[model samples]
Target: MGIDACTSRPFRGSEAVARGEVSWGRLAGPAFRPLLTDVYVGSSAEVDTATWVRAVALWGRGAGVVAGPLAARAWEAECPWEERELIMPTSRRETSDEIDVRRDRLLPDEVCFRYGVAVTSPARTAFDLARRGPLVEAVAAVDAVAFRCGLTSAHLLAVAAAHPGARGSVQVRRVVALMDPRAESLMETRLRLVFILRGVPAPVPQYEVRVRDGGLRWLDLAWPRVPAGRRKLGLEYDGPEHRTITGQNRDLLRDADLDDQEWEILHIGAVQVFDERRADQLAARVMRRLNPDP
Candidate 1:
């Protein structure tokens, strides 16, 4: 009867019409916003994680199981939100604008229920995304799920080992090998990968540094095993969050304190990550620091 039932949650248009709570004509009007083909949310409601999960329920129609990035999102793993991805073992069919449907089967233990919708387990979701494409993002996706789900590299390797001939299995192995639980952001993972792929010594993530004022600070990327008397190097990705005055002031203080403790800190932003030249220069700078001339 009220928008609360529909907008506050994901509801099928047909469900409301069949219950006589609303006329078919009313369901198609401005009062409701379409989430998928037959799914609608309250027009006034803000679409968020819960809404996305509910939309998955309506779109799935009890047949498909949520997979890929949507499953990762449901598990609270960090990833970009583009569209809802679903997989049904029933048949191979064309995908609709509402969601992506793949004709793939999951093992009995690979599916679980979350947000009132059937979804791939965290490990399964990580494996699925790792096999899906662009290696760097896939690696970041797996790292995120592992970090949040308390999964280890062994778990990811075990999952990869189970699917011998699966597509991207090799990439999955590579991603597992590079997975780091301490990585807290996609940019950090990407930057780390850049160093590895560039044949530079990989830095420790979330390394602890003792500040001059007795406070503890964590470095995003650090060469902590440098010689006892030699200074250590660190690289930090400064995203949009660091652009504000408060953030900048905090960073300045943190940098000064770390500098006093023999840390050679380098700061980069989103632009450096996207530009190949900038990324290469950063890698070279790190390498030079790691293996400085006599």
Candidate 2:
């Protein structure tokens, strides 16, 4: 297992390209040694690897995959949108052998890397991990490979046809058609997963609601789950950055509209999101709203 640069924690699947064959040696400047574990720092030839792409792929792991931008960048594939995180591939599928020592595990539906190590055909890669990735990132990768890198959606569609019933294939097709890479955010994806893991019905994300005074308002999550014919919300993650003085007033007015609509909102702040009491607070509120008795 190689250590992640960010966490320094040992990851499960990192494999050095040539066991101990390469190291920070013979550099003209600073003196350094390999860390007690795996990572090395402070040498200019410091980063002796080919590139970030090769470093990650040539030795990536579980939390690491042929990741989105890195994957495209590896082949000098042009990118259509900026990226949020590096995408890594898993070595689960048999294709790991076919994908090059550094590629990812993929379903026949989601990916297709050549012997040359270029990205897989578009539809295949998208279908493979579109749902797993933050949605926008997923779409951006698709755009990077398709519109920018010259792989076409029609070609990807044909690939999907060959892998019928691939878990995320159909959704991948929809995203291919509707993903507006121009206006998507990674935060929305995290919130969606939060709700999913909490067992709350998914919200209509980025829904625009008009205020009584004619200003436009966008919601992080719009309660789409109808219970007793009302869109009552069980909880809300209210980070302070968005709840500053100006933000507070807007939220107050928005809450008024939501309250009028019979929705109960539980505001969760950054502290609450990470605090010890968060789980208890969220559970109590969600249950209180979902099944109440006088």
Candidate 3:
């Protein structure tokens, strides 16, 4: 029964510890720190470059790398993301050889880096996707790049210029022209998109809405919908950006004004529109308010 000094049991993860690891990242638990949510073992260290490539192969585009959505989540960014799921970009001539999945291949204008942990280079991600990404998603990504990641429209434009003959070059230039780096945040941009998608007429962003005797209130999404019967509906996107006491008070006053004027108002958010369970319900509400059944 002498202790075998040379053959100490290698730390094959103990059963209890394995269970402990599994319990991290629960909805409300202190230990709950999500690694890959459904199919990844938690490794405190960033996924080494080799493992990152393997994960890309097995999980395709949904897998969260250390620098993927995890980075945004850890930083607590203001954009709408619930399950650490961030959309990954792929190359025009994407290849599954170097990395397991076909990452949106970088166009000639797209910039990239080797952070050792895989990530879209800020310049590359913002510029390359200026035209291709969903309007809302692109705005958020640009926010992440410019505000959170410290890139600018000029930087993105430079990247686009780098690849004169690349796919989407012209469109990227156009989008850059339209993008406003000074936009308050990604959520604000999505608010603008909500109006576009819901067929609410385009808004004058940062427009001031005022009553004759009142001060100005900046609108998130303002649209003039329908002129029949002296009625109209104005919409706004109330994302988490303005969930504070001050913001709540401001909106309350705005609501009071619209109520007095008989101007219908609509409020939308990522959860109200993007949540699978309630998207239809929200759509119905919008339709009912905008086009009532007589």
Which residue runs does candidate 3 get wrong by more than 4 Å? 1-125, 128-135, 143-162, 167-183, 198-200, 239-250, 280-294
Residue 11, candidate 2: Cα error in Å is: 28
> In model 2, what lDDT does residue 15 have?
32
Residue 211's lDDT in candidate 2: 52
Which candidate wins on lDDT? 1
Order candidates by TM-score, high to low: 1, 3, 2
- Model 1, span 1-294: residue lDDT tens: 544434677788788888877777777788888878878887888888768876886777778788888788898888854658888878766568778877876888888999788898888888887886688888888878887898888877777777778888888877887889888877888888889878998788889887878899998888886755668888888988889999899999999999898888889877667788987987887777777467
> Would you give me the overall lDDT of model 2?
0.47
CA shift at 237, candidate 1, in angstroms?
0.8
What is candidate 2's lDDT per residue for 10-93, written digit by digit as tens?
Answer: 211213324442333321124333321233333323342123433343333323445444455443444433332223454443
Q: Which stretches of candidate 1 lie over 4 Å from their true place?
A: 1-6, 92-94, 227-229
Greater-lDDT candidate between 1 and 2:
1
Q: Which regions of candidate 2 deviate over 4 angstroms?
A: 1-187, 194-199, 224-231, 234-236, 243-246, 256-263, 270-277, 280-284, 290-294
Which 10 consecutive positions of candidate 1 have the poorest summed lDDT?
1-10
Q: How would you encode candidate 3's per-residue C-alpha lDDT over 1-294 as one tens digit per residue?
A: 221212222211233245563322331243222233233422333444334333432344333232333334333334343222222463433333333233344443332233333445556656545655455665665655566666677888777676677766766765665555544567666655454556654555554566545765555545455546645566677766558899788788788876665566666766865674575566555555556458
Determine the C-alpha RMSD for candidate 2 after optimal superposition of all C-alphas.
Answer: 10.8
Model 1 TM-score, 2 decimals: 0.94
For all candidates in order, the CA lDDT equals 0.81, 0.47, 0.50
